[model samples]
Target chain A: MVKTVASVGLPVDEVLEIKKNRILPEGESDGKKKRISIVTGIHGDELEGQYVCFELIRRIEEHKELLKGIVDVYPAMNPLGIDSITRGIPAFDLDMNRLFPGNKDGDMTEFLASGMIADVDGSDVCIDIHASNIFLTEIPQIRINELHKEKLIPLAKELNVDFIWVHGANTVLESTFAHSLNSRNVPTLVVEMGVGMRITKEYCNQLVDGILHLMETMEIWAGETIEPRKPIISEDADDVTYLNAPTAGVFVPRVKHWEHLKKSDEIGWIIDPLHGKILEKILSPVDGILFTIREYPIVDHGSLIGRLLREEARKE
Target chain B: MEKKIIYEISSLYRDNFRVTGFEFGEGEKSVCIVGNLRGNEVQQIYTCSQLVQKFKVLEKEGKIRKGHKVLIIPSMNPYSMNSKERFWPTDKTDINRMFPGYDLGETTQRIAAGIFEVIKDYKYGMQFASFYMPGKFMPHVRMMQTGFENVEMAKEFGMPYVVLRKIRPYDTTTLNYNWQIWETNAFSIYTTSTTEIDKESAKEAIRGILRFLAKQQIIEYTTHEGYKSSVVTDSEMISVRTKSAGIFDSKVKAGEEIAKGQILAQIIDPLEGEVKENLISPVDGIVFFGHNDPLTYANTAVFKIISGGI
Candidate 1:
């Protein structure tokens, strides 16, 4: 089934619409069943989640016998932002993620946010997928506000992901869709991977499998008995260390992501673009495994080009 | 005046990003002024730059009293300012929201950490802050209630209003709230506009800061006796919301006195040019904030009035 989330009349005699795809199990008996919502592309620039949405729908269509619960997928909530490849909603020029639990009678962005929230309200488990910003690559991971770790960690571990980072002090956590949903007692896992405006097929497939496994574990689908994939998770923000640019130049990276390096290992260099001279040689500070590295090279001073997960940084 | 680079941020193509602070005097850290943590904060940055120009002359003329240090940073997010982007261009994050940041954290976090490391120990921290909502405000001094809040010191600014807001959970990451938590008498000065510079308001803001400094005995300049600021808690403000969405034609400006049931604005249908609804004042008071945006949303706050039975 398909539904229009919201519609706005455009000035040029056209209409802008946000749509959602809903998939239900066949021939229901008694009306007691679970519903899981998989939302993605709230950020118009992050498109990896769209692929996961497609894969989830495709797999469900192929294996109808294994499906017993309801699946709702919001592929692109900000249709105009996604269409224009912009980071925020068009016309309003606002971040939809920051306007969650929105006022129904508020402005355009808030109206859209309210509709999106209402569409997913009362779901048992909600999943928000995202791709990292355009300038970097990321391993598939789940992110939660540090405050929600005690209640959310076990739920996050159910999904197939490489890392789980508990971040601190972002006002977005109080206003974002996942956080608002969690506050309403609905558990949500925010997944991130790949690069913005692009799709990582492997990451999408991995998360799709994880989602299916979680469904089985939740007894929504009784066809297959599945074991939860234990992922490398960190409960504190300090488990990952960021390496930033040292000078203004074209950065040339020497090591790939997910590679291990010793302290002082040469990871990259900043070249003075005009003079073709070496400006600064970037090196690793501690013995750690690099999980995030800069894919797009043009950076400013203090720009994050790499992130390292320390070997033994997590608190036991 | 000595310009010192407090923190260095590495860039790939442009020059190394640096947060530079202009030092006026050389003893104890007395006051630190910051502006433009995000782009679109033109009024804040403009006001601070004017103060910097004024402070330079004051320092040379021996107006800055001895044994007191003053620092003014006109901007902390020059990259975003250059592009007219409100947040960090690459990551789309807000630098203002990352206060007392972690050195090993993300890019914005590191920037906040670096800037906070230099200014956190000051006796007073003042920021020319823009409102989260795009609107016009009656020039005021605002302080968060952090248990260490000093409302009396805030009144020294002599702005028309000294607003006290109990901090919300979201405010924990903002610079104003963190400064108070760190024991600095922190206050945020809100001017009239965000994107456009109102020279009149800018002058008024400059005078207010000068008045505060003179009151604190940090400077020797004599300024006009501005308003004996009225302390208003956030809860005391009465908000007027729009009943319909359209082009908003405001009949009242900020700081204007109004009686109950007075017409404040009219929402007009943009296409047909017909009046949709009239925004009337619900309380007899002074306008604390008048929404400056030409277009308004239905049920959105357009006017806030201080309901003092004056």
Candidate 2:
């Protein structure tokens, strides 16, 4: 069943609405059933989660007898952004993710965010999915803050992602959706995958499998689940190396993404299109696995080209 | 006044990003004024430029106190300003939100870190800030209620109002909030306009800053006494939101005295040119803020009025 989580009147007799799809075990009373929410599309340009939402619901409906708990799917949290293909809210030019735990008495955007938090407050678990911006493509990974490491790391490992990056606490995290929930003692995991404005089917499928496995662990699903792959967990900040463009040029990749490399390996070339000259040869500084690569070719000085996970850290 | 490049980042295609500081006098770091962290804050940078010009004359005349130093940075994000963008041109990130930033973080964070390192330890910090919404404000000094905030100090600015805002979670990352946390008496001054220059309010804001500096004994200058600033909390203000989305026709401007039930604005339909709604005031007060944009979306706050009493 579909329900409107929040609605606001727009000009010209129009209305802005956020809706969610709720699935419950067939013919069973929802009394005290464990609930897991799958949230996505906080950024309009991120469409990878849209496929996951569809696949999760499609599979759940296909086998109604195997479901024993409640599942909530919130797709397109920023519907306007999705409709217009903009990263932020269209008219407001505000990032939706930054307004988490919003004020009920605040403006339109804030009120909407508040409503979302209220609706998802009592879930047993939540998975907030996101995609990298248009500038880069990320391997399916879960990012956790170090403060929530004790509670989230074990849960994140069950998500079948390639990497679990535990970041140090930052002030900006207070206003994020996952942080808002986690601080409230609501277990939430943030999953980042693929690239902006496009969906990767394989990535989406991988996440859907992980979500099912998580549901089984929470006893929310009674269906068969696959054994998820062990993921590399990086807690130390120094375990990752960022590759930045040395100069402004078009980047041409010399190696495939996710390829393991030795030190001084050529990863890409920054070439000047007009002069047909190789301005800079981007090389790996350490032996590692390339997890994030620039999606868009245009690069400026200091633009991030890719991120490498050190092989030694992975082995540990 | 001595001009110095405080923080700079080399750009490959464009000029190196430089945050230039204009300094006056030569000893204790008494005050630091920042302007235009966002690209579209033209009025803010303009106000700081005027201050820079004033300080140069004051220094030449030996009006600046011997042991006090003042630094004024007119514009911080010139790259975005050059491209006519409000935030960082490449990443569209707001530098104002990345306070006391991390040096090894993203571009905006690094820029913020570099700027904050030099300006953090000043005795007083003032930021010419623009509102999130495109609007006009009745030039006021706003301080975050961070427990360390001294309301009496804010009143010294002598603006029409000294607003004490309760810090929201998002406010924690702002420059004003972070500066206060770092033991600096920080205040955000909002003028009448952002993208466009409102000379009258600009002059009023400048006078307020000058008055505060003189009162603090940071500069040996005399300026006319400004407003006897009324202190008010954020809860004392009432917001009027539009009920319809259309071409907005505001009936009044900021700083106007309004009566209860007064028609504040009209929402006119775009297609048929019909009046959709007339926004009426609920209380007799002064218009503290008025939406400056021509269009209005449904449920958008068009006006913020200060209630009848403090």
Candidate 3:
């Protein structure tokens, strides 16, 4: 079922609208089924989630009996931003994610945020999907906040991602949609994959499977659970060490995402573009996993170009 | 005797960013001054860069006291500054708001983490801060209301007003609040402008910072006596706002004392040539902040006055 949940525009002019795709069980059950929400395109530039949303709906369409509960998919939150290829809301230039649980009486952005929170409030679990920004390409990862680690880990591990990063409390803003929803007792998972403005077909399909597996874990769906392909993990954000450029120059990357690294291994190099001299050789500080590398060559002093996650042992 | 590369950041683009700081009297980390963290903060960058130039000469003259070191990072977020942007270029995030940051987080968070790793150990920190609003403020020293706040220490800088702010929930992530939490006496010095260089206010700011270092016995240089700052709470100030939106005409400037009934500004209708509203000073005190934007919005704060007896 599709419904125009929120809209804005004059009666005579073009009215902007947002539609929610609700997939319900095939037949009326004895009891109310649990609801799971899948959100994507909060950042209008991240296109990978849109494709995943499409695939999820397609699968549900094909096998209606496999779905035991309702699936609410907000395929694109900022349609105007997506239309313009901008990261911020088209008219206000505000980041919609930062204004979650917004005031209905406030400005247009806040009203929209408030409406969105209301739309997904009672879901048993919520997923905020995103693609990495323009400067970097990332391995598929599920990032869960540390405060909800124990409550979220089992489900996060079931997400079939390459890595799971549990962020400290301060890492994610309280105003963010994930935090707001999670704080309200709705378990939330943030999935980041591929790159901004473009959809990685491989990552999209992989994440769709993870989402399905999560639904199965919650007993909301009867489907084959997909195991993680690469399950390297970090206990929390503290387990990550950052290597910054000590000065400005062109950065030449020496490593790729998901690569294992030894202590003092050269991760990248900073070079003076005009003089063509080697200014600094950046190195990994610990024996860990290199999960991120700056894709852009130009860096300012103190810009973080690389990050390594200190590995943690898995619980049997 | 010369500049040193304190930190470097390599990016995907054609150029690299460097945080260049001048080092003097290498001993204990006595003080560290940070310049613009935002791109549009040209005045803050200019003030810190001038201090760097001055300190280079001071280091040569042996005026930096023994067993003390001073570091001045003139510019940190130059990528945004190069393009005159107000935030990080790629993500449009504010670096100042990500203080004591997560090393594994986004770009701004990582940048803040790198600097905090270095400067958190310093005895004192000074940032040439700009206001969130586009306006001119009376040169002052601002400190957060962390348990470590020292209004007396702030007065040493000799700015006109020493304002202490209660830590808001959102302020916990700012650099000033984090520095205090880390045991550094962090003070934010706001000059008159953000993008435009106010040379007079900039000179006063540089002098005030040096005066602070001198007061701490970190340096032996002689300087003029600065303001015996009136320590004010953030709540004491009254904001004078415009009732109508239009082209603004101000009758008073920043730092000028005003009476309760005096006219502060007039909002003129942009399309129709007529006075829409006349804003009056409601408090008998000095103008602590003045709106510099040419236009005014209805119900917008145009000036912040230090309301009290003269």
Candidate 4:
């Protein structure tokens, strides 16, 4: 069965509007069990998460016999953003991700966000899928709150990702979508992968599998036994290194993404295109994995070249 | 002599209030030229004042003859004009949105009604405007009603651009919108201004209004230069938005010719501090309006480039 959540303005006078597409279980006798909900495409430009949601829905539909608890999938929470092909809905210029637990009577985006929060209030768990913001390439990862360590950390491991980043409640504030859900005592996790404006099939597949693993663990799916995931985990408030360009020039990188590096190793070089002068050589500050790298290379003063998760440098 | 007055409401109360107007002639083709309902548009006031003063001089010199008692209300939002705001005191509702007036509505609605009541009947109406929206727009005449005569008058204005715009029928409070309800011919002349009006655009708008009045025979004036085009539509106005959110740095100017695929602007990453995306013109055209300021978010209209026509 399908259900429609009428937001502030009665869900846009259309029969097949996005908000109207809600999937309920086939023969669910009980509604007291905690339910896991998944959402993607809060930002229009981030398309990979939407693809992941589609893939998961198809897989779930194929094996309906395994379904038990209710799982709501919102593929595109921000329809206006998708229509305009923009990240933020143009009417109010507010980011939906940041407007969670929003004012229902405020501006347009805020109202929508608040309405979504209200709709998902009693859910057992929620997962928000997102892509990088049109700048950096990212490895598949899951973010959990440090405060909800016992609840989210176990689920993070079950996600079967390369990295598990435990984000402290204080560090991310209540501005993010994950924070809004977590604040309501909901076990929320933010799964991020792929670069902004681009997608990787492998990364999307990983995210889908991880979500399936979580579902089976909750006994929502009575399917075959799934393999547990071994993830490289880090504390929320761990030491991190910011790699910045020392000189103003065109940056050309030699080190590839996810490459294990040593201290003082050459990561990239900045060169003046006109005179062929090598202005700066980017070197790794600590021994760790290159977690992320800047894709676009026109560098100015104090531009971040890459971010290295310094595993060797421990806190004093 | 039915006299005109500027009620400097600043003296009457703490908040500012004033009435702007002009009156001349008496006859069959009565007209009123009101302008700049939005604030941050001082150019319309200047042009209307100049035109009314011209009519006043002709009437005083005894050279005036025939057609229309003209009323020109130059700048309605005197407080906004003074403070460089686009809307009313606190509501920030566009005065244009508050049409046909409301007795119990907001400040903007009340003012809109008062202004409408003053000039409901006129044979032909024209409203002068300058860009208060954060970009440079070309000098053009916009009208709602259909008919070759309205287009002809717009052409007669001799502006470089003319647009036969569809003023949404629901918006009946605007001067042009109201004039249409009263069965009067109306057009809006738009050019450039927000904090400051561009001089060349201002001159072209004034010249267009003069040419329009001349053809109406309200005052005998002549112009040898031909109009750039007969008219334009809302479809012709192509608005270009940014693809990414960041600090915007522009590379082109309004009215400058641009090639297809040429870089128009670049969005710099606030976190990384580099040019992340370079916005380019998808079609060959002339830049109509580009944001002069650098700080802008993604998907916001950075420029409006128009193509075709000489």
Stretches of candidate 1 off by over 4 Å are A4-19, A28-30, A88-95, A98-119, A144-157, A165-172, A222-230, A236-239, A260-266, A284-288, A311-316, B7-12, B15-18, B308-310
- On DockQ, the leading prediction is 2
lDDT string for model 2 (B11-89, tens) is 5467888899999999999999998999999999999999998899889888888899999999998999999998888
Q: What local distance difference test score does each model get?
A: 0.84, 0.90, 0.81, 0.69
Point out the worst 10-residue segment of candidate 1 chain B by lDDT: B9-18
Alpha-carbon runs more than 4 Å astray in model 3: A1-34, A55-72, A75-119, A157-163, A167-175, A209-316, B1-30, B49-71, B77-80, B83-122, B168-175, B210-310
Candidates' DockQ values? 0.27, 0.44, 0.11, 0.01
Mark the 10 consecutive residues where model 3 chain A has the least summed lDDT. Answer: A7-16
C-alpha positional error of residue A311 in candidate 3 after TM-score superposition, expressed in Å? 9.0
lDDT of 4 by residue, A16-90 (tens): 234624444576654666588887778877778877878888888898788777778877788777778767654
TM-score of the second chain of model 4 compared to its true counterpart: 0.85
Q: What does the lDDT come to for candidate 1? A: 0.84
> Per-residue lDDT of B1-310 in model 4, one digit per residue for the tens?
2457533323112344777677777776467787677775677777666767766776776534575577778777776677766665333456665666653343455567777767766777888854433666767787765442367656777877777665332334455766776777777877765456566776777677767777777766667565656455766767676655667788988878888899999888766778878988988888877887666644456787777535
Error of 2 at A226 (Å): 1.9
For model 4, what fraction of the real interface contacts is kept? 0.00
Which of the two, 1 or 3, has more lDDT?
1
True contacts kept of each: 0.29, 0.40, 0.09, 0.00
In candidate 3, what are the lDDT values of residues B1-310, reduced to their tens digit? Answer: 5477766666645466677777778789889899999898899999998888888888878898899988788787888888877788856788887988777565687778888888899999998888866678889899988889988889998888899887655678888988899999999999888889999999999889889999999997788888778998887778786655678889889999899999999987676768878999887999988987777655567888988754
Comparing 1 with 2 on DockQ, the higher-scoring candidate is: 2
